[model samples]
Target chain A: MSPLAAFGTALTALRVNALRSFLAMLGVIIGVAAVITTVSISQGAKRAIEEQISSLGANALMIRPNSSSRGGRRGGFGSGTPFSDADTIALRDLPYLAGASGTIGASGTLVVDGINWPSDVEGVDADYFDIRDIIIEDGRAFTQAETEARARVVLLGKTVERELFPYGGAIGSSVRINNIPFDVIGLIASSGQSSGGRDRDDIVYAPVSTVRSRLSGFRYPGVRDPVNAIWVEVRQGYDVETVTAQLTDFMTAQRNLRIGQEADFVVSNFADFIRARNESEKMFSVMLAAVAGVCLLVGGIGIMNIMLVSVTERTREIGLRLAVGARPRDIRNQFLVEAIVLCLAGGLFGLAFGAAGAYGVEKIGEFAVSIEPMVALIAVGASSLVGIIFGFYPAHRASQLNPIDALRYE
Target chain B: MGALIQARDLRRTYRMGGMDVHALSGVTLDIEAGAYVAVMGASGSGKSTFMNMLGALDQPSSGQLIINDIALHERSADELAAFRNQTIGFVFQQFNLLARTTALDNVGLPLLYSGMATKERHARAAHCLEMVGLGDRMDHHPSQLSGGQQQRVAIARALANNPRILLADEPTGALDSRTTQDVMAIFDQLNREGITLIIVTHEDEVGAHARRQIIFRDGHVLEDRR
Candidate 1:
């Protein structure tokens, strides 16, 4: 028999037992739904993390002072000798460097119109905004002259602006940080939340010179113009790894550390960090999809059970067909088509259910869930495969029946 | 004319509880084209086995069985299936019509294996149903039809492929005597049209309608007469 004719027969049989067919497909439906929902949500989270990493500057690198051990007592990172202004100047002059900024952070309460709010005040150079991709939504960024002359100018993050100046006009406003007056020069654009669940817009920016000399009072022993960390941006077309290696070598040489002596600094690339995070997330998603795949397999087994039952129940019909000239292949094709059609139908419904489930998750849990087209296609393909894999045995059994004995079946 | 069916010492044996049970042993017969033959026997008389062999549904052990010039033992199972489709029509005592399907579709089932188009299959099925006096009940399902009508539908299905041989195993066993006569009349009409017919039954009344009768006893043909 033609495959189309066999398919028609299968469709007719399924329609005759519509409720049973649907019940048989329920396992596949739930299985595909679980797989699609889990994969899409994880992919969405991965995409969100990538965006966060890119916002921090795709080519940016963080150079921090490494923790030191004194008498077997290891202090935390940044507890050792911090980067000096000379070290920042030396790294800034590298040929492949786009720009570099030194930052010194201090937690202080800012009083604005009798509203006091606790926030981090970051000391930064004029190049900090460019390195961090922090665009000004209103007012201008800090000028080089302001950084050099230690002017009391500050950039307010969106969160700080909202808290301190809820009624707009945050630009040109005067706010006291540690009782020192500073002019708000710009409003930093919001960058949403970081992957670590920290608010990215809760801090304020000011000139590093003004912060170090007046507000923070931080000066590492034997270090001139002590800074907590240095933000480095690689020039376009220059490999980040190459620039990172150059900077590390330059820093180590300038520190005058002997051979086998651990350097007191570390250079970390944001891109590498993002890649590592993506890899872990992908592994997690694959594990989740594997669990969901087991559910689909269970569902496929359900289909096989039903198909076997159907073949047994229709033995007399099969015998009649055989006597009427149906080839064994015809009987086999009919049952196989029935199974595949069931799975395909279940997959379609599962796609819809999975999409709905993803949306529901996003709404209830406030998590990202993206339904990529490729994921849907893969899911449907997998379900069809499941049908074929599980549907073969029963179809083969039905095809191998002896016509005489089958007809004699009561 | 050459014999339509030629069997030489046909034998069929089965193993039941590790013992040989001969369903058909050393049976030989010849049936000509357009002949109406009745195969009669009591239960366990090997009549059904002989009928199954003649229908190409089973192969006889250690015997040469030929039908329409094709040796049954030499053919593969799949080849036999195709051979059956092209040469034979079968009607069982239970009618064996597919449930929940319309009489027309059930009748057209054999044509599906022939790769016939839907329109042609329907047309042939309709013509066969008309021939069986069931043309008006084409859309009715088996459950909706009476036992006699269901049997008629089964007969129509058997004729869908225009097979040369019609094989019926106790076709009227489940019907009332009035309906039995009705079914026999249809068979008699089909036989008059020069189609070879073989009917297996235990009832003498059913066998009396055939032009020739062969009786089996204990796995051998005890008598054959016109």
Candidate 2:
């Protein structure tokens, strides 16, 4: 018959079995929803990872000492002296070097006229602000000469400023770090928070040279204890790996470290972090796909069972159709369309639920949950296909019914 | 100018439980256009088998049978289905309308197989119901209609395709005398309109009403008379 006629006839039959048709469609809806939600969560996780990693810095590379021993046990956390002023100076000489910094942090209290706060006091130089995208709310960072000369100067994050110097306009005022007084030279603007809230405005900065020379006495232990990793900025379009290698080699030589002798350091550029996130995203995507696959399989089974029941219940009906001149495909298509419509409607329902689910999880879970349009499209498309594949055999069985036997089936 | 159905040396045999059963034995027959014929026989005399072959629903084991210029035994399954839709209509002893569908939808079923448009299909199906005196029952489901009414709806469905041949296994077999007369009158009216008809029955009265009668005994035709 004409496809329209086929559609009408099929629809009429399905309508006659309204409750049964709805039950069959319910399975598809659940399947589609499961697929959509899984993919959306996986997609959200991937985006979160990328956002976390990309926020690090584009032109910056980090080098931290690998102090782990033979076991899972970690060593002194750094050479305690692997990174030094010599390495920082050498970094400045490189062609692609945009900026450089060596850090030395000491957790201590900062007090300004009895307003006190627990703060992390770290040594920083010219490149620290740019590498971390640290903009000043007021005033400016201390100069290189000021830092080298061991001037009593500091940069205060907004939170640190509020707690240690709540009176406001604390720049150019003195604050005590570990009871050692330093002038607050800058107030850093507020950065909200990460999923981990690691970047809150609650810290300060001093020059690396001053911390090493006057504060910590520059004892030359393991090249210079890294309060933490150092950040090195490269010029735009510069090969970060080449710069990373040069920096590593220079540190190895300056520190008199042996080749493959556990160079006592690790260097990672922007590309490395991005590559890591992409890998993790791909892995999660595959995992979500597998989940969707399982859902489709279950959904298909539901359709098959329902269609089998339909074939059995309608034996006489099938006989009548055959007697009335229905071709095999006509019979097949009628049932197939029923199955497909069930799946498609379910897919639409799933899409709605998935989007809401992702949003709710993101809000309630206090974590980023993502849903990708293409992934959702695939989920829906796959659901319909599953219904067709699973519903095929039952439709075939119904089509193959013998008119004589069916007519007498009573 | 032509015999609507022509069978030459036609035979139909069946295997039941690994044993051969000759359902039709060398039954040669010719039926002309616009003739209302009744096939009468005792049980297992192969009257049903003969009707199936003539309606192009089954193949004869030996010899050729032609209906409306096409070889019945030689046609493919799909071609036979198409031929059935195009040239034949069937009414069973017990009315066999689909239970879930409305009378209108039931009548439109043959047209559904023929791929007619929905609007035209519905219009023609409604018209067929009107002709069968079921115009008011167009929206009724099969369960809602009486036995005789259901039979009338089946007849309307059979006529929906404007088929040249009408095959009734036992048209009045389930009806009371009053309903039987009404159905016979409808059949007579249909035959008068120039459609060929074949009715298979065990009833002498029903057989008597047809213009031609073919009697079967032991899978062989004993007599054919006008």
Candidate 3:
């Protein structure tokens, strides 16, 4: 028999048992659908995070207490005071600096009227919102004059505003932070969640000057008291590495640290931080792909099992055909055609299912989701390959039957 | 009648439960062209084994088996398949028509296997159906036809290949009296047209219809008479 005849035979046999064939294809449908949805959603998440990280500005540099590995015992810059308050001033005085701010973190429950919400209070000098892409929703951030004068003012994040004063006015209300009453000066717009899904709006703000002088008592000796962490905004085109290097050298000289001894500060580049986040997302994608791969493998085995049972059921028919002059090759082609047709049909349906799955996810998220045509094509091709590979043994058995014994089989 | 088949010392041993069981034991036979022969045997006798060997569906354990002067045992398995298609036609007791296919396609199957183009395959298939008295029933499936009609379609397929030998394995076993007579008449006419035929059956009336009779007991031939 020619290949077409063999194929026609296979197609007819499959059609005869439509329900069983469809059930066999179900494994493929679920497998491909899962692969498409997982890849699209994960890549979507990765893209969102990368976009958020880039919003921090590539040239922005941060100098923390000390690298976490060294227990924050100042090593990369200036003395052993971790981040002294003078590091912020010294970094600001550099020629390439456009602006600078320092942050000290503290958490407290804000009480306005009868409302109480847990909030993160970031002690920042002026230019914090501008440098960090934080938008003020209601009015304005504390002015340089107010920050310098150590005013008792606050800005509510969008979620924080909802929690503390959802019904009415919060701008003029007073909320106590660490039992220290502060005036609500402004509100920050919803920055959505961070790349890590933390709520950006769950925060309150206070002046770094006050945090250093009174509210906070954590200190390392050596610079105008001490600071928690400092971030220097470099010129738009200046490299963070060059500025970090210059600041580190100047800080070392000022604090008088030995060549091999640990300094009190650690400098990190913005580009490196974003790269680390992206690497984490890539690792996550690999893990998802591995899981999806295992599912497809099981689907392949299911195809093989069904096809083998079909071959055994049709053994007599195969023998009769052979007795009537079908060559061994014709017999082989007949069974193979059944398997290939099965998988190819499964693959097409799987593509449709995967497409619909992706569309559903996109509609729910209301964001862009990518469906790679090449990935679907590869999936279809793999299914066909799987059909052939899994179907080979049974088809061979069908082809090798003795025509005489087969004819007499009852 | 011309000599169409010749055989000598044909032996077929079947392994039953990992032990050798001889199904055909040293039997020699000759069948002439256009002769209608009946092979009679009870269950487990060597008669059906002889039929299989003649149909080229099985190889003899030891023997010289020839069909139309061509040695079957010397031929490759594929060559035997081609030989069977070209030389021997079979009619099973079950009628053995592909159940879902139309009567026309069923008759044309041999030609389809012969690589006939679709138009020619359908044309020749129609012709074969008409010859089987199924001209008006060409498109009907086997399930839609009577047992007698289905057997006729099987005969049409057997004739389409224009084989030298027609082997019927209890062709009327499932038929009633009327359909059996109708089928027997068709076989009679085909034999008159000089097509060699062999029928394997236990029915004495069926055996009486053939010109020659060979009876079997166990794995050996007991009697041969003409």
Candidate with top TM-score is 1
> Model 2, range A90-168, lDDT digits (tens) per residue?
7778778788788776677788787778877778886888876778879888887997797878888888877766578
Against the unseen true structure, what C-alpha lDDT does each candidate score?
0.90, 0.80, 0.79
Evaluation by lDDT, superior candidate among 2 and 3:
2
Q: Chain B, TM-score, each prediction?
A: 0.98, 0.97, 0.96
- Which pairs clash in model 3? A74-A263, A74-A264, A75-A263
- How many times do residue backbones clash in model 2? 9
- Residue A305 displacement in candidate 3 (angstroms): 2.2
Give the per-residue lDDT of model 3 (tens digit) for B1-226.
3257888898998898999999988988788888999999898898888888888888999988988988998999888888877888888888778768789878877776676677887888788777778899999999999999999998888887778889998999999889888888889888988889999999998899999999998888899889
CA RMSD of all predictions: 4.6, 5.2, 8.3
Q: List the candidate numbers ranked by lDDT, top first.
A: 1, 2, 3
Off by over 4 Å in 3: A49-247, A250-266, A365-368, B1-3
Query: What TM-score, computed on C-alpha atoms, does each candidate reach?
Result: 0.83, 0.81, 0.71
The DockQ figures for the candidates are: 0.65, 0.47, 0.42
Supply the TM-score for candidate 3.
Answer: 0.71
Candidate 1, what DockQ? Answer: 0.65
Of 1 and 2, which scores higher on DockQ?
1
